[model samples]
Target chain A: MSSTLLNQVAFYLLSAIAILGALGVVFLKSPVRAALALVANFFTLGLIYFMLGNQMIGISQIMVYAGAIMVLFLFVIMILKDQTPEEDKSLFQDRRFIFGLLSAIVICGLIWALVINPTMQSFGGEMDRSYGSPQAIGRSFFTTYVWPFEIISILLLVGIVGSIMLAKRKF
Target chain B: MNTFLNLPLAGAVYEDIPLGHFLTLSLAMFALGSIGVLIRKNPVIVFMCIELMLNAVNLSFLAFAAYPNSHVQANNAFESAMAGQAMVIVVMAIAAAEVAVGLGIIMAIFRYRNNVDVDDMNTMRG
Candidate 1:
């Protein structure tokens, strides 16, 4: 059906953009550029989330990550002024980079062998009406996940306090 | 058919995307993130790579939640599926907290030294 074709087209296009953004994040020379690339990647990922039918999460991905978190990253990167050192040109010249590439290959291979084949055969059925709406997630949060919810709130508070302490001049 | 177009586009695509595709995308992103983590030396860049890894995992979690296991009991399906979304929410919260504390640590370190390179952080090795 044309609908399925449309879906595939959209997905592949987004995937391509997402991958490019990710690569840009890794390979770009400047910290600001890398952070900008990450922002692109996050935005693309949010769209993919929307395509997956979790509207609530998609919004969260954009707002929390692309909006707030990236801004924080930018602020720090600006303050620190991190740029690629000129002498460190050619990523291939570094032993650690080669080792890193090999390690990445091995890790991907292991995951594929262990996790991918046995499961992920195929998925079926359409998304239910209101599958991942805020209403549904909220309902689950207050009832089934209430304890974790409260714990996370406390964790956030602790994080705020700890960061303030770390930022102070003397401990 | 007119009726097909009348159906929400998300519903049509929703029924057809195999779980494998989502997982593959997630895996690729995770690999990219790992590479970034390994090769990048800047601490802030390293932190961004970690965020990449986290988002990759979040994609997988959402995929699984969207297309749950075929074998799950009917009555528990909603509950189980909801759990995955809930986990993703928890992860986002944790990531936010982590960024706060982590950036603060990095800033504190930068204050101690003129410039911050993670390699210079080996003073603890002494």
Candidate 2:
């Protein structure tokens, strides 16, 4: 078969895996198990990006998210050295569980409706073109979005400082 | 009955799945993550759910970048796709910083309270 057909198959498969992983992350009780599930989800998402032709994003998602962020999570988990605590009874006191269930049902219903009826094809019907390159992203970041780029750097700086302060003992 | 049963297999070759498929997948993932955030009590699990939501948004943006029909139809595909990618870049940066800060807070709270339950933080509710 042609390469495009290959891409479609890959996309469907990866998307399925990613969604399942996300579901696992949500449903799992142990934080460590949930974190592992998140890693799987990230890997599947990276594969999806690869199928979409954004090789750079695919790689970054794996390297940054699965590698760096997850390691950070595991490090914190280890330092805390806490096994799964008793499930917090106070958690079920509120109507949050009911709310969450309702929200999920409503959202799923909306998605099913949209998928079946599909009146508005708002996003993707253009001719196939290569919008998948690092240079393109770089140029745009340096150009119109330059201010926001600088702002994001500042935000990072603040986040780092804040995290350090919070983690440190004042005495 | 024959063609109906064989339809998916038949047109699987020519039928290029569009951005909508990816968007729907992303939405479903995001919803799962949202439920985790709402339902789960563990701090780390909550944070993981947040990350999942971020990934879902990133996926949607990437799909739009890949198929910039809106931009292409308007004769500005290159610039529009770049715009979408730039947004994702910024989002990833912010998400990274948020994770760091969030974990730090969790660490401090754990040190002080010996637990990270969100409901347990209701100290001011006299």
Who wins the TM-score comparison? 1
Regions of candidate 1 where Cα sits further than 4 Å from its true position? A82-87, A118-120, B1-8, B11-14
What's each prediction's TM-score?
0.92, 0.85
Distance from true location, Cα of A7 in model 1, Å? 1.0
Q: Give DockQ: model 2.
A: 0.37
Could you tally the backbone clashes for each prediction? 0, 0
lDDT of 2 at A158: 96
Deviating ranges (above 4 Å) for candidate 2: A88-95, A111-128, B1-15, B70-74
Predicted candidate 2 versus true structure: per-residue lDDT over A26-143, tens digit per residue? 7766677778888999998887776666767778889989999998998887776663355556654658877997888898779757752362355555443455567756666688
Task: State candidate 2's TM-score.
Answer: 0.85
- B1 in model 1: Cα distance from truth in Å? 19
